[model samples]
Target chain A: MTRIYNFSAGPSMLPEAVLRRAGEDILDWGGSGMSVMEMSHRGKHFGAIAERAEADLRELLAIPPEYKVLFLQGGATAQFAMVPMNLLRDRTAACYVDTGIWSGKAMEEASRYCQVGVAATAKAGGFTTVPPRSEWRIDSEAAYLHYTSNETINGVEFQDVPDSAGLPLVCDMSSNILSRPVDVSRFGLIYAGAQKNMGPAGITVVIVREDLIGKTIPGTPTVFDYKKHADNGSMLNTPPTYIWYLLGLVLDWLKQQGGVAGIEAQNIRKAQKLYAAIDASAFYSNPIDPAFRSRMNVPFRLADAGLEKIFAAEAAGHGLVALEGHRSVGGLRASIYNAMPEAGVDALIAFMADFERRYG
Target chain B: MTRIYNFSAGPSMLPEAVLRRAGEDILDWGGSGMSVMEMSHRGKHFGAIAERAEADLRELLAIPPEYKVLFLQGGATAQFAMVPMNLLRDRTAACYVDTGIWSGKAMEEASRYCQVGVAATAKAGGFTTVPPRSEWRIDSEAAYLHYTSNETINGVEFQDVPDSAGLPLVCDMSSNILSRPVDVSRFGLIYAGAQKNMGPAGITVVIVREDLIGKTIPGTPTVFDYKKHADNGSMLNTPPTYIWYLLGLVLDWLKQQGGVAGIEAQNIRKAQKLYAAIDASAFYSNPIDPAFRSRMNVPFRLADAGLEKIFAAEAAGHGLVALEGHRSVGGLRASIYNAMPEAGVDALIAFMADFERRYG
Candidate 1:
């Protein structure tokens, strides 16, 4: 079978090495005679696996000891509700920076729990830019400020971490986590859905500062309570064991790629190649401001909308899959996560050039 | 390596054939270059996988046309809250039967959203017997009646479906789903966590009546909203794709095992042999009433309680792993699901007899 590069916004491409290792161990993890999926969550084997996976993730992200990592279900979408349920207390409002689909979703869910103030919005710019830090309207009485570090749908990214003043800074890093090195100590909490650059869709990784724990509303479900998850080491409910195992393999692969620094260089170069290719041709255009263009998830449009189908079909023929943009924003989106090799970006660029030549 | 029989309450054993087939196909599913975990939820490959998985599940369960099958996350733990959120519709009261740890947890979470009336309790019977239906004090005006058909932790099950009398009858069938046949028409809704007889954790199977659709309160998160999941065909969010794939394999295995009816017979024989061994000896004792002993999860205590550690360690030495009972219940729980062969149960019985002779 011909090799293919998947550019899905989430549930995107994973390193082939991780895939191979996961396949080899799917049925009998470490000769335990049971698939990771079948092992008891409390079994010593899975217990060790879960701890090691979290430890490796901590090392990969340079997470501080004060931060508790939770392996939660329901993805980042669930966190949108959980964040407010856990953090939106003793405050008049929580601030949200609306960049794209995910941030808007966060705000919508938070509104159900507390007053959600729009601290900033690039919506006026058609979501083609991240609002400048100076333009933010943060509330002095805000419980916490929430933002998305990278927007998958609109291909917009906050190039710099916002100054939250005295409030805790929280971010949905779903589409951008592990694409580059990050200072974990700078934020109060960071959550990422695993499907983008981490591992799979079943698990969400939540890193929260220790001081932020133990404040859930009385009615919050146990699984959604960060305090409960941290207290039980993320096995409060039978966690997604197989996904945790797969993520461990990805973390190992990341280490082999010389850690986050090495992968970041490749991700930057790959995104640069695709964006450069799009910029070099009038037939294709990426609308996001260059200053805020995402290193992962580059959404672009063809000059002639009529050729969108042809571009997608021809790309698929060349082993480039899932390059279709999110339906919320109709165009093409190339998600160059850590696993998307430079070679894949080169292939996409080559395909884009050939398509332009044929259609222009 | 000695083959081990896993008696974990959940995150339990799967069909060996299913695990083998899953291992073979983990990296490249049906010639697709990507692992099912890496496929986009909206892509044709995964879309077809999800659709077929649901269709096969509905067929296996004999789900009525009026019931909408939803694949959700967060396990039955989350469903405890979701059940009240979507079904109670701000009603102040609902009726819940307290049978074991699982039912107690359901009530605990449901209490957050509504006034949960304890309709019946098996605790007085040492949590081994199901409350007689005639003694149930279900509030006539409650929004719905909730029960756990099979309690994994306590090894109790309600053999007969309760009459709803125009009220919705919701059940948490987490441990016993797909193990035996049931009348789907009797239930207003049924939700099962996939760790037991289904496939893996992270995916929940929700079969809701068509009338129970779209009643979620305004604050309900989109992921937990039954209406949202039903409207989008359970693709409201990126589901646990690999888990769904494994579940499909399990459904295929169930069909080959003569569907639910065939598996039910095997389960009956397995439970009967194990229970008979315990009852035939003064060395072993099961506290549960014989009439309500679960055919799936058989929890038995020893005549000499001081020998619990010795019994557990000896069993582990023999490769009968995860036989330790739930900490809350403090006894040995042998969860003999559809995957546990009669030979495995016989092995357990033989081991128990030998252990009793040595330790008694």
Candidate 2:
């Protein structure tokens, strides 16, 4: 059977190996004679899967023993509010860098819980670039600083981690997590919606330094409390079991792909190849600055704006799907996340070249 | 191809048909060239799946257009917190009937937001029976009256809907939803985690009266606000797409099974057959009141408690799995949800009879 390369921004592509294993196990996981989806969360089989996934993830990221990895639900959108609810213990104000759609959303949700300080914003540039860290206005007395490590919509990414000046730095790594390795000790908290670079849409991976948990605002919903989930190992409720199982397969796949450092080398090459192709063609242009262009999401525009629909449709016809950009930023986007193979990128680049030859 | 019958309480048995279809489509769903797990929530393919699932569910329940059906994440435990956050509008106290574990958890979470009146409780009876409505001391000035329709852990089911006396009645039908037909008009809200009787663990089915939404307590998390989900069709954030698709397939299967009424007949016969098998044998007994015993979860004890381990081990040896009761209740519990075929129940009864013959 032929397979189309999927480039969905969040609920994007998964490793074919992972999908194949998951398919085989979907009806009866590990010979237990039950689908993973049908297994009880408290059951020993799923418990082993959950534990192994966590251990694999911790090994992958070199997560400090002091940090807890929580497999949660409601995606990263829940974390937008949860971060403020749980982290804003005594301080009433928090700092944020408004890079693009994801962080902008986090800022809006957080305003309800505490006073929000837009320490830096790239909105003036139509969110096409990240503001230089030196220009950021941070409140020393604020609770914590938050930012999105990569903006999925605008295709902007951080060239270097922003300094919160000794304060806890919380990052929304929803779109770029596990694509590369970084120092875990630099941030107090990191969260990612599992749909993009991880696995599926139903789960969120929250890595929080132990000290930041268990101190949420009074009246905070128990489901959003970091302490409750961390304390219970994210089994405070029935977790998204099937998705959690899929994530384990994904972690295993990542390990086979040579861990984060190995994947980072491949990702760097893929992004460079795609970006070079875009830059070489006058027919297509990515307006984002070179320093901050996203390694995952790559949005480009045809010189002739009206041709966007035809471009998207033809791409789908050619077995390249979800090539349409976010409506908020209209054009064509190909999200080459961790699951995306170099072969898919080459195919997309080849298609872009062919399309330019036909149109130009 | 030997298959084991799984009797897990939640995340329990699913129809073999559903599992087979899901496994077939695990790599590519509906010939869409991608798995349902890989589809974007906002895309037409997933949108169609979501709309169709909602429509099928509505048709099965004969839900009023005046009521809103929300496909949410975070399971029923999240609802234990969200129900009060959203439903306790302008009211300081909500009345709850404490039947078992789930309802007790709900009251504990709700108390964090508003005063909770325990109108009635079955803890006095070891939670083996539901208290009569006449004995409930409901607060007329309260927000809404809440109860668990079927306590999965306790093996107690409400035979009839209790009077709310003009108060909006909310029911946690997590274990027993769609097992039988009920009057939706009588309930202001009905929420169920989808692991049992529905589809999977990641998605929750919340059907609420249109008038009861939009007035959540201040500082309510956006994801917790029922109105946002109702207005946006439960796409407030990315939904659990794979689970949603499975729920649609389940709804389709339900319609083919002659809807709720047809299934209720089968469910009754199954429950009666199993209960009879346990009651007639000196080797086994169910302590729940005959009238109030749950048709879904049938918890029983062996005559000799020491034989419980051997009974469970022997059952598993014979391909019956997950029959161990909840830790809170140390007994054997079989959750025969809608997906549990009558033939499977027959197999269980057969096993019990044979075990008794050997050990009695």
How many Å off is the CA of B31 in candidate 1?
Answer: 1.4
Task: Supply candidate 1's per-residue lDDT for B1.
Answer: 38
Candidate 2 Cα misplacement greater than 4 A, ranges: none
Per residue, candidate 1 scores C-alpha lDDT tens digits across A1-360 of 445888888798888888778777766788787778889998899988888988899899889999999998998889998998888766658999998888999998889888999998888789988777878898989899999999889888877787898789999999889888888888999999999888988999999998998887656777788998899998888888888888888998999998999998888888888888889989999888999999998888999998887888889888898888888778888888898888999988988888888889
TM-score, predicted candidate 2 vs. hidden true structure? 0.98
- Report the lDDT tens digits of candidate 1 across residue range B10-121: 8888888897787777667888787888899888998888888888888888998999998888999889989998998757799999999889999998887889899899
Compose the digit string of candidate 2's lDDT tens values, residues A168-243.
Answer: 9999999999999989899999999999988988999999999988888877888888888988989988999989
Highest-lDDT candidate: 2
- The Cα RMSD in angstroms, rounded to one decimal, for candidate 1 relative to the true structure is 1.4
